[model samples]
Target: MLPPPIPSQPNVAIPTSWPPSAYTYPPLLGNIQTPSVHPSGSAGTSFGYSQAHQQYAVQRQFWATKAYQSSVADTITLCFKILREVPGKPKGILVRNLTEGEPNVLASITPPGLRQLGIQRMETKLTAALRGLRVDWTRIPLREIVIWVDLAHQPPDIAYFHARCMTGKEPQPAPSFKKQTKAFELAFVIDSEYWEEIEQQLADDEVRSCSFSKISNRSSNGRRSSQHTLDGSTVDLESHARRPSPDQEDDFELDRASFNRNEDHSPVCAFSADLTRALKVSVTAPRTPPPSKRRIIYQSPNQDHLRDALLEGGSSYSQLWGQGPNSTSEQIQFFAINDCSLNDLLADRRFQGFVCDPANACMGSLVIEAGNYLGIGTFKTAEMGYLTLLHLTAGHLGPRANEPVAVKRMYKRRKTPTDANPGKWVLNRLTSADEHSKILMEANVLFWATSIMNFTYSFIYHFIQSSSERPPFEISEIRFVRAGVAIVHNQSTGPTTLKCSISRTYLIEERINEAKDGFYKFINNGSAVPLTMTRKDASELSEFLAFTQHVQFYKTKGAVYLSDLQGSMQLLTDPQIMTSPLIGEGAEIFGDGNVPSAFNSFPEQHCCKHICRWFELPELAASTDSDTRSVISNS
Candidate 1:
């Protein structure tokens, strides 16, 4: 008899201020309007500008020498100290050079417009300026350039900036700021490896600058009195500082007319086109999906009668069609009964004792000794959406005797009230029998899928370990549970009466879903699809599991692949085996969860990351729009 369900823990009301002060940041400052200053060209203004510029130069000099102190040997750190703050304007943005003697001033921009120009634009400008200082990026790899923006606010508004790699053909979008404090301090960390390309872009921009100047001078009647703002905003001296002459005014009108006529042919538009073309030609195509659609073809003769007979009150269901020996050889014979190509793969010596081999198939029968249940007739029940798990002890079973084990059964849904016996409930016999068969079928396919996964993982692990180069992270182990269907006898009813067809008990630790779909969905790159977990969030173990799946899909020639991965860090359970429908017609080949849509979506969904690339797994060609149409039509 099954034990009563364990009582659930009582819900406790959480206090609004339950989180202590240590977890929270100080109150944020309110937004303030940025003032626009029209420079009067007074001695005071000139002196203030010169003083701010000098301070910036000194700050740059300090960082030039001290930059090596904070970073590793291969990287360079540039510190940008905010000398002056003007709300909504760029001023006093400075960084030091690596060269000795005098510190080269980088930029003098105010704080207001820095956020608008964004971190990526600032990094690009810094990179161009740094290149002008003749710093060898290759020697000290500038894959990521960190910019520290120290705004001289009352509470110290500080920020760090970096850009994402411009690897794609399209223009990379500007990075958003992540607020670190109550103050408007932000952190924008991005990365890019194309240094040479950026240098060329700077050269193009320089040419555009010259062209812009020539046109501006022609418009202003060759007066050439203009001040270029540090934040890329232009300030006209004739308009702001002094009244314009009639000839200058006429020239300005003419220049405006000319600029309006050639708006589409502007230098910015031309530069954008050139940049897009260069990026498109230089960048490699994104990763393709997994190859292979071959699924496991289960040719094992139907054993539905074994489950039916048990459901009809038989003592046991044996693979050998009779009373089997109480020994390990009996279990090995049970696995041999499957008679499929997957069984052949499992029989290999590499997977010996792990899942199956000639000697052992990680399967055995345990006799439930008298009054030996661990909780003494009591078991804890954990109910999930489709199955109910009972936590109990098998008792006096072998090496694992008295250890906690979990027994799983499908939730019975067809209970009817008995009129003859008032208040008594009875399950529909036919539905109960069908559910029993399903439980056994699911267990059988699960075992087969786990064996294949284990085999593939073993191959990939050994391959990586034996290679000349090592991966960045250590390859962690991932072992799925070895389970099988078993028949429980109801001794209380009478010695030979069948109890139920259920899964053999296996222990589990704290469980977590590493990846999942309808059963187990593989996470894609975060850019295209929104998922709870992506390639970035995957741990070393998850990556290895993903790689295993990749190899299995390809090695089996795309016949079958495992997904819906969930388990402890080392041990996993309840995986979904996705088989191509081309191999079999029915969904029940593996289980009800094995759908054709999931199988078809594999190429589009799976995001190949480091481990896949490390093994140099062959890329799966993406199906074109026409191919998809044909598949839909055929289906």
Candidate 2:
């Protein structure tokens, strides 16, 4: 005999005075089957056993009463089932290990419960409760059923049911990257006439189950040949829906002959009453293309080539990316991709190329990962570790797009307070505002250098603070421009310094008429000199004057060579020239390109050397020995 029912607990009352059609929970009752009792136990049970049976019978009777039906007992039972089965919580499958004091459904809902059931948050609690009764979906509306199944962690079939109910339309399945990808190998497999027969059988029979038999292909000679069994039933070869022969329909043939209906050359007007049904069937059997085929293309970086391509001067790009002398910890922080498994995604070439194109040119999704730092001048040395324009577009590295971009990772260096060496470098984290300030400061410096000082280089695209905790990266949009050489033939200024103090605008004004006249003279008689402002000419001149002024100011302020501007200038000079190539004029190396004597009298190298000189201003050294050593080494 089965164990007797448990005793009834005090029930929570549910409201029920709403409209008749209002959503209501179906009444839950204990199984109504007649209880079986063991004959031997009934004849020889002890007093305690007898009392237990009486109590059990009373409890079962109590549940059967109207009072039990009026309470939240059924909802509570459903809630218990969901709490037991759902995943990813203390009570769910994902987190099997629960805290010592976590409450179960029964404990949570009881009056003496440690935690309240949280009825005020009805959506979460009530939705979960309804979803717990998954097998009994008929109690809920179609829409509610869909949402409940989704939230309950039910299988995808629930979604399919909702889709079918909404519209007798099948949804196209998305392409899966996994191995088993085919949906159906054969198209139009089912015969429409056979399906109608099954429907008729279902409507007519009391059979608890129905199954397919076999479908045979019709041969060209109007005979059934290849046979396939579905269940045990044989599919008929001839369809009853087809038009009957004229011999079979004698009256129709007679009417056609009598009225000359057969050959009036008029079209027959036939109405299809089941057109909607046919359309529904056609729409419900949607065909989706098979999964995409992918070919793997691996790109392995050359460590030596990459390492050799580090940024110039004291700043090392590799340090930021753990490719240089400094370890990763020496830099700020890392920006990790959120939500998705970036490693797995990146490993798949198709996903990387199509989905995660850093340039975001593809039609698919795009994700940008950049580090963020908190302050201005984070990178005191030369910026490094940023992606190059070539690398970004080169199919061997990033996406195959013509878009050009240069990534620059900047950082600031500061001396630790407790360190003995006052000028020693140390890495530190900054606040978000500090990072914003740093970017703004760089923008300001570049703006002034570009607009007021007439400096020129690749322009910045935009600033992005990807992560506040990590050092930020910058992008430079590359625009190709042809460079012409301009010779500065001034004898008064040094190769790294400028002869003129005025800006490029005034220089242009002073030489404009002369340049026009010279050009006309040269074109006509091949006699005059050329006067043109090549790339970086203005920037070089400006930097030269700026550096000179900086040196003068710092020299008066008691700055020494080793510890001040002079030492800095030495490191920057080489890189600046390489980048700009206009700072130092070599008349013999680059032939004097017929520049006007008047304009050439005040030209700087028009290369990056002037920028280096500006960045690296020399201070007065302690003695001739130190100064001579520095000068000799720099030269």
Q: Rate the local accuracy (lDDT) of all candidates.
A: 0.39, 0.24
Candidate 2 contains a number of clashing pairs equal to 33
TM-score of every prediction relative to native: 0.32, 0.16
Candidate 2 ranges beyond 4 A from true positions: 1-379, 386-413, 417-423, 444-635
- For model 1, residues 514-546, the per-residue Cα lDDT tens digits are 343112333331211223443453445566666
Over the stretch 370-413, how does candidate 2's per-residue lDDT look in tens digits?
33221123253222222212223322212432222112223456
Cα deviation in Å at residue 202, candidate 2? Answer: 81
Model 1 residue runs over 4 Å out of place are 1-398, 412-432, 490-540, 622-635
| Candidate 1 lDDT score relative to the true structure | 0.39
